[model samples]
Target: MGQNTDRRALVRDRFDRAVGYEGAATMQRVAAQRLFEKLQERMEGRVPLRILELGCGTGFLTEKLRNAWPQADIVATDIAPHMLERAQQRVGEGLCYRIMDAGEPDVSGPFDIVCGNLVFQWLEHPQQAIARLGRLLSPGGILALSTLMDGTFQEWRTACAVEHEESGTPDYPSAASIGEWYPSLFNGGWETEACVQTFSNGRAFLRHLKETGASVPRAGYRPMQLSALRRSLARFDAQGSVVTWRLAYGCFQKPPRAGVFITGTDTGVGKTFVSACLVKAWEALYWKPLQSGLAEEAGDTPTILSLTHCAPEDCLPPAGAFQAPLSPEAAARAEGVTIDPASLALRMQEPERPMVVEGAGGLMVPATETLMMCDLAAQWGLPVVLVARSGLGTLNHTLLSLEALRQRGIAMAGVVLNGPLNPANRETITEKGKVRILAEIPFQADVSAQSVEGIAQTLPSWADVRGGA
Candidate 1:
């Protein structure tokens, strides 16, 4: 907590000194313009959007938003007071201007759109921050932002590498990782572009960063000596270097309606059964995004079909089905098939009935090299129903799963405890994890359709699910 506070202080101090941001923010301006255009495309036909803009440095993007949608109730905010003041001076009144962290917005939400420009990279926990922001959006609302990505400043990085010196540039996340940050219920993706900016020499590049207040290095980095820095600068200048700014523009939207994303503490936990109960209870659509282990056993979807007696059309096809009995990522690789997470992110169209999405394995299990089962849940923007065994080690596993979901700000419908009843385990999870005990399904000698129907009757209503939805 102290470290995070110190880091935020460092960022605030740096940006406070960046009085020249308006003049020096070339790439920032370009990104703001493009971000606005992209947002315009997404928001077409939707009027009077309740827009909340994060890190509105000097009002570059805020101005565009204002001019673009005068009807919008624009709430432009920043962490630095100077930047907020500068933005107020640029765009003047009507739009609410506040000095606050994007991770902790003081304003109420259900905002039609939440946006930012060239500011996401500065967040300490970009993933967690995005999840928190997603909570602020209205139904069908979007969180749009552009940020510096991993490949940015490669020229300077190469120069530093050649000079055997450290570079001050913070390591940015890749587009794939950024995509994973969004809540599973939200249909989110990023598009990348490399915008090149030329500077006279290495000193100029360093100065440019300072002018834009982007000089904050990653925490715990040792600064190079003046001599070493000068040498690296020389190397950078000698290389015919023009810096490449790898930018990723992302858009994540809260669905107008969604259901629960069912996952488990472990692979063998009763997620399939819990999902079956929910589908049967709500008469909802079921989608198993990635199915593995065809070689070993029948997948969850078929079992769900038989258990729920759901129509074939109600069972949404698996986005990626693999023959190997492994994690989705590993299974895809073994089968020589590339699965795009964006391709897998399908929400029901005008969902009249709820949809239950069942994930294979545990939350941390990798769906891809860059995405986890949890990331898919966050992306889909549905409230999660974390199922766990109700005995012995269940306490730790259930708490961990709850914490993971809380950290991502993924809405939770609650935990469904399965197996032999452990009142102590149930009490501990409810008290320690601060999660509702959605259901307690005891062991059944014959787990059949009749039993499932009885259990489904005990589950919460659609309104309960939508409460978190």
Candidate 2:
């Protein structure tokens, strides 16, 4: 048999054994819980929310959804007949199961919500599937999706590649790269949001993929020697056998209104500071679409509140906050938080005010395997105001940031230069760059309540610019 045929047969056989396959691990349960919460939020009050679950292997998620919303009309579809049968057996009335290929999923009616968890990677054409999914949504309906990114099985791929020449089989696409495929969702009539997350190491990681039936066949590739596999496993041992996974989660609304996005030149360059400034200046609602460090109450949101003197209710954090003081993916690994970008967007949509959103780190910082902060910005369709320092190399950082924003097609409101003014650098930033210097905040000896209050004086009247005046 051909490789494709053999692989399909293997997948079908695995589906047969996977019947009634409830996820056995606490982590898998936790992941399921997160996905459920996201779906609930998106479908809230939209009675009879028509939902379609693609690749519903073993119906674990379908059961969870049914329990959560008995009123929901869910169609659970899978390519594997055995998987569809298992799903039918598990789900009671109000749920429908069908055997269907995800790459070319065909179903009736415009669904209010289209969900595919850990399924996109297995398909031959994910982009086409996503576009088809978009078309499946009802007007104003949402598409909440989660997929394993390219970094999912890095160690295994590497080991297989070195030991076996054909071992480095193509894995799933990255969230960042995948974001490129659906620009119309953001740039045109749709409003989109996306995020990326990472896990610690290989065993736990592979197990999650297995439970979801997301494993790819290694046939036609160089066969892995047992010794090499053992050595690769050893490398993951130091990291507690934790394999990192990247998931791109996002929501796409059919039609979007005006929104705002915030970007920064580099970490510690004051994206949060400027976000807070804008919130205060505009009295806009505040949201940190993705937050990395949750330990420091003195971190992003707190800083914004301190600067703006806004009540705690004014600022909102993302769905998942990592305890580690690093990036979202890294912090999530340390804290055992499964970061899903679509889940974060659902959490962030609560606040109704003109929003002041603080991004984690700089523009390209990975929020998931396939997505970065800039992608999230573009998804929100926010006219961005870049935050940068007024020191040496500010010009370079600002220019690169602007270039990235331009590449992403994000509109720029202007730039905010923080810290003590370096005359030459500031001149270049304003004069040579030919970009508006929205504000110039002088360096403060102490970033205290008083210092923050003083700096607020230098801020331009954002109310005029931000349309809240």
Candidate 3:
């Protein structure tokens, strides 16, 4: 407990000097620019757009926000007084810097925008912070923010765990859970958008966190010993200092919103099967924007239709299907077919029924030269259901896939575990892996037509399978 306080204080002291910190300024500037661009695009010509930033740190983001909206009134708040002092020094006019905790933001008024960068993990009650932000925002106002996700510091965590079993900690919350925290946001009339970004290594990565004043420990969290920390750092060095972080960014718009986008784990994990089941249960139309590795006639759309008993006319294929059993890009190239994601989306768009579209391969798999499956999922904006094979090795794969989807800001509708059940694997995946296995489909010799009927009979209802959807 004492250590936690000291660590927090040390972080506060480090960040107090962060505004004047050198070397890392360039990276911080670049990140700040990207964030500013996103906020600027959202703000448009709204005169004097009111902007509120939680945990403004040394004011890097706050300064960027001020520059982007010189006419806007920006209020930057942080729990660390020294950090707030530095932030005040950085931003003179149109920006107000205050020392305030995000969990209990003591600012006034319904702002046009609430923005924060890499600050959510330190809070004990992020959902409450989000709800407070929601209450603070004016009608139609949006909350644009970014934070360190579960995969962040994975290398460091692993290294620490070997020497000190209890030292390493669990990853941060999934973006889906973060989204689900505010059920009222969706059903109570609000539109939300979220995504995650992954970073490559530890020294430079940790340095970035410090520079941005985002390295503060949680309020009541314990700290590891110095010897263990040194050993962990040494291990990271031995491993070529490979480090990674997952950052989730999101924006929630108040009222009068459209729909949400959905994405899942990797390919052949039953995304299509579960999507078909969802469609049948909801009486929704089913669509597959792009189908790759089609066995001439045995395509994903057909398989889904057969499973759901949808009409043949409802089974839409890709704009250009290829015979080669390769990735969509490679397959299209082999078949000399132009693969346009937009064209494929246009071909699959249905005006009636809640459309369930299946993606090809994993989130990061390239569809075209420039687009990935995740890019398409983000573009479409549907609530996603990730399908994972129900067995060993799924824990890592599911977590990684969830991390990928989170980074892309895709809304996941929970996970569906297909294939036979393995008790050990399921326990590890759900407990240690921190993923909810919504449903488990036992292994069977045939997922084919002859046995699909039997499979359907055993299959649980969509809502029940999806854990009440």
TM-score of each: 0.62, 0.49, 0.51
Candidate that beats the other on lDDT, 1 or 3, i.e. the better one: 1
Q: For residues 1-469, write the lDDT of model 1, one tens digit per residue.
A: 2127888899989999997788888999999999988888777567756899999999999999898789889999999999999999999899899888876677888799999998878776787777778788887787898888898999998889888877889989887777566654565567889999999888888888998999999877899998888888888889875899999987766765667788999988888888889999998899999999999878888988888898898888899899999999999998787888778765665475788989989999999879999888876777788999999899888899988886665767788999998999999999998778889999977777888899999998877756533
Stronger candidate by lDDT (1 vs 2): 1
Q: Alpha carbon lDDT of residue 311, candidate 2?
A: 82
Candidate 3: Cα lDDT at 109 = 69
77-173 in candidate 2: lDDT tens per residue? 8878877776687775567888777777778768877776656656666676777777776644666666656675565556545544333334567
Question: Which 10 residues in a row give candidate 3 its minimum summed lDDT?
Answer: 183-192
Best by lDDT: 1
- Candidate 3 lDDT, 207-236, residue by residue in tens: 666675556554455777877677776776
Off by over 4 Å in 3: 1-113, 117-124, 131-269, 293-295, 309-320, 341-355, 374-384, 392-412, 443-469
What TM value does model 2 have?
0.49
Error of 1 at 401 (Å): 26
Q: What residue runs in model 1 are displaced by over 4 Å at the alpha carbon?
A: 1-3, 260-280, 283-469
lDDT of each: 0.84, 0.64, 0.62
